[model samples]
Target: MTPSAMNMTKEQKEQQDIDDWLPITSSRKAKWWYSAFHNVTALVGAGVLSLPYAMSELGWGPGVAAMILSWVITLYTLWQMVEMHECVPGKRFDRYHELGQHAFGQKLGLWIVVPQQLIVEVGVCIVYMVTGGKSLKKFHDVVAPADAAPIRTSYFIVIFGSAHLLLSQLPNFNSITVVSLAAAVMSLSYSTIAWVASLEHRRHGGSSHVVDYSMTASTSAGRTFNFLSALGDVAFAYAGHNVVLEIQATIPSTPGKPSKKPMWLGVMVAYLVVAVCYLPVAFVGYYVFGNAVDDNILITLEKPRWLIAAANMFVVVHVIGSYQIYAMPVFDMLETFLVKKLRFHPGWPLRLIARSLYVVFTMIVGIAIPFFGGLLGFFGGFAFAPTTYFLPCIMWLIIMKPKKFGFSWCTNWICIIIGVLLSLLAPIGGLRSIIINAKTYKFFS
Candidate 1:
């Protein structure tokens, strides 16, 4: 052992060992493209399938504007987080809460960021659990015989969660780089398939084929709620900021050359890929199916059997990786608490039990309340808006202290204002939709 290691107290040595073994801090060998792959996996996920349904609620003008505005705003917010990762030389904010602690104060920052970050990350895994289930059911139905017996979505959800029982044990983010890369590719692929299939549906149209652009809701209250809910959906689509700092932490930071340069480069490329995946599926899918579009565009498209079936399988695989991407951070938090606060021994047994229980918990909840669209709207607005849209902006303004009324000041305020509005208004619609669905929904079916 080194002289310093020999001199270290038992507690300090144990803490250092934990730091070396923990997932986020364990690796610093990631490349810029790792950022691209992880960002793409996190960004272009289950939210894309719902964009068409969100558009149907929003109609053309607002839908197009919301999509464009969110793209630009989120890209800016992501840049802010990247820059702040190593803002203090010789120190790094390796997790969202760490950055929050720096900005808000130790206790207050953890309070401000942890709950919101947890909601975003844990909420996503729950939603993706539902998504994976739905996607698997869709794939099976497409390939099975016309007379084949139907399967409960709950069963598929359990099956999907089962994958995580194995995968959740993976050590950290860098460990899943290959899976994340494949998911990035799959997200782009399935998104392309959704739009291409949608376009083909339009081109082979009959003279009588109708594509109505009118709002589908019959009541004024319903229309208002749907519009608010659509805003949440758009907000949900740009949800990579919660993990930007963690992803950047994987890339080594040095005094002379900060990690932000390479991280920023990766995100620029990642955002372009996001636009390419998001826009066409949303616009074209809604344009083709109009008010009749299913919340999942893949559910709306039934033709070209082999292709659609393949797309659904891709969704299952993509979410499998996306689930892990979000889950690793949560795992970090859980393990840290257990080891540091609860004083549990830091070893494989603690990790296995903690992670497995978490997987089961989300699985049961997903099966019990599998309202995909409503959950997206609710969680999207409530948690996602703050973290993805405005939390980082708020931190930037606070820490950087840009001049009052200047361009930076004005822009950050604009994003915060919009984010606050979305957070306040959108959940009303989402909760209402859930309640209405629940009146008839039988749990665990």
Candidate 2:
């Protein structure tokens, strides 16, 4: 060992090892805008499409409150993640599992995050496959020959999955920044379209005259269950916390300088964009359609055929971009295990075959289930509540070990309690919703 290395403490040596493993290459490093693009693409996804439906369930006051609460809680956890990364003194825990190991002890860290991260991310890809296929089919129905046999959504799933497979081969996160930027723009594009369409529909008196603005649910049981489900939906909407560290890793840190500034800047800009995109769609769509808003607000729009079609097209594109951004972490994790643990050579052949097989696997699941709302509820409640809410608070408490009964201590404990409640109740509500809707469920329906 080198002289300085030989003299290092155990913690210092361990930190050095991690730093060596995660060297930020010039090509892989990015600027703040690139980070912002990645965060926006990761955060604002197909979940945003459900905001209006969530509003329908919770009404204006409660729905907006839920959305804002989710946003603040998620943003706070994101900051916690950044703080935890700096906890090891000189070492950087650039991956989620690393942070887990640091806070929860060695093997427990990987066990804690790997399965849930896979569920949230792989689940998202499956949702993307289903949503993309449905959007494509809708677009086709609009423009295709009326006499032609209606194409099944599975065909479009394969077509889009193939495209995703191609994009997945782009090697690393920095390489996909352009695609993510396009996705951010597409998110804005489709959201703007939905908002404007809702306004016009309201002005022109297109649908039912009455708009329900009451905070009461349809039934008392519904108020409890539906509100829980709405909270889960809002949680799902902000589920990008799980991947924030991975996104932060792409931005190069200057020597001896705090990286949190650029990281916070990117996060702030991205969340600002998220708030702008989410509020209008939720409010306007709910105002226009009230309790009748469809799970995907775009589906509720009937007139302005071209504009709605354009918006759906944007959804497909944005999800395509989103699928890759989210899946890249899963791909990295799998490939790392294969190469480091199994001794597989780090080469293009392995990457292409492994990633392609993974895509096919998600696509198959998408075809078999093809139930969008159920999967959202399941993943949102079962996976996201813990990953996005529970774990971050726990990690901070563990790492920081703040003074007992202090503000940080109380706040973290409160968050932990909230997260636990969400984990237990949200999934029950989500599963119930899935079961109630199961009788009508069909493959690709």
Candidate 3:
């Protein structure tokens, strides 16, 4: 007898075929909690890195409010996932690029997706490179205490970042899922610890200055501008949900294509989990440091000696995970265009050239923008605004078949309106600060 006929019951043979057809590590194969955790981890990743800096403009109230707004947006995106499953069921669209094409049609889809993908890829890489440099610098300060040049900080970042980016090209969900979970643990552990430790600073009675909301109230323009600019930070914090949709096609099906309810549930739990983790940190960091919190909280805290090295490693680990997550889609896109479509084989020569170029690119950008806080703010505010806020609502209205207008629609429209306002706000706020006050907007500073 053939292997399939001899060893298996009819039901067993059928089930094996179904499992074989399903992609390995697809979203369907992921435990519901795993998907939830994957998304929640990414959501918190951006916010935690950003909260220390956000304290400046919004203070505790507004900064915390801003992150809360991120959660609200998360809720909206979760609702979109429900609608997405309803509209684009089964394997109708395997990637976000395909979703964009289906929603907006080919011409308009390319316009939106190409730039969005590029921005996400480049922004993620830049963040990793910069974060790596900072962590290395921290490490050098601890180990050597005083070194003339400290191993040419930029050189160290280029070397390490290049190696990691190359590793990222070999796509595997199991590896990434593990990393995502690990990132979540580190992010939550440190953020929670940091939040608790911050209480110590507050109990010691740090200086306090209540922001005068009325100061900007005289002209609604400035206050309007401040709130709008703050929205970018909020959008950036909430921007990772779209990533889930890209990975949704990977799940295994028992009988037929799986129901989207599990996926939607995972997305929802992830958002709520992230909200729980981030809100407290934003609240405490603002409350503890007040208006003086550094853009990257790692810079502000003076932790125990033992924890210092761990803290440096924590940042490094976070960036490593982030780089892998962000780079996957970019590599996927390149593969689609080059190997899949163009029929260019994936050869050793091609891999060698790509690795060399990636290294050079990482170094140049890393050295130029040594600071990432402002760069993230700008991208979160401007580049990602359309995708996070504007694109989904527009897609829902124009593409998805409508049954009844629901609360989901209501929330997404609010996101759309907020996103538009922020896109305008980022440039206006940046320019106003510059032209009026002669202050320059710094990318990393």
**How many pairs of residues collide in each model?**
0, 0, 8
The C-alpha stretches of model 3 lying farther than 4 A from their native spots are 1-29, 82-86, 146-152, 204-230, 254-259, 347-356, 403-408, 427-445
Q: What's each prediction's TM-score?
A: 0.98, 0.91, 0.80
Order by TM-score, highest first: 1, 2, 3
lDDT of 2 at 233: 77
Residue-by-residue lDDT tens digits, candidate 2, 1-445: 7777676776586544433432222143678888789889999998888889888877778888878878888888888887676566666677788889888889988899888888899988998998898888777776667798988889988888889778988877788889999999999999889889999998886654777655445678867887777777777888898778887777666547656668878989999999899988888888888887777888888668888888889999899989998888888788777766787766779888998999999999998877666667667888898988879988888888989999988888887888788778777767777777777777555
By descending lDDT, how would the candidates be arranged? 1, 2, 3
lDDT value for model 1: 0.92
Clashing pairs in 3: 26-250, 26-251, 27-250, 27-251, 28-251, 29-251, 53-295, 371-444
**Prediction 1 TM-score vs. true:** 0.98
Give the candidate number with the greatest lDDT.
1
Clash pairs detected, candidate 2: none
Of the pair 1 and 3, which is ahead by TM-score? 1
Highest TM-score among the candidates is held by which one?
1
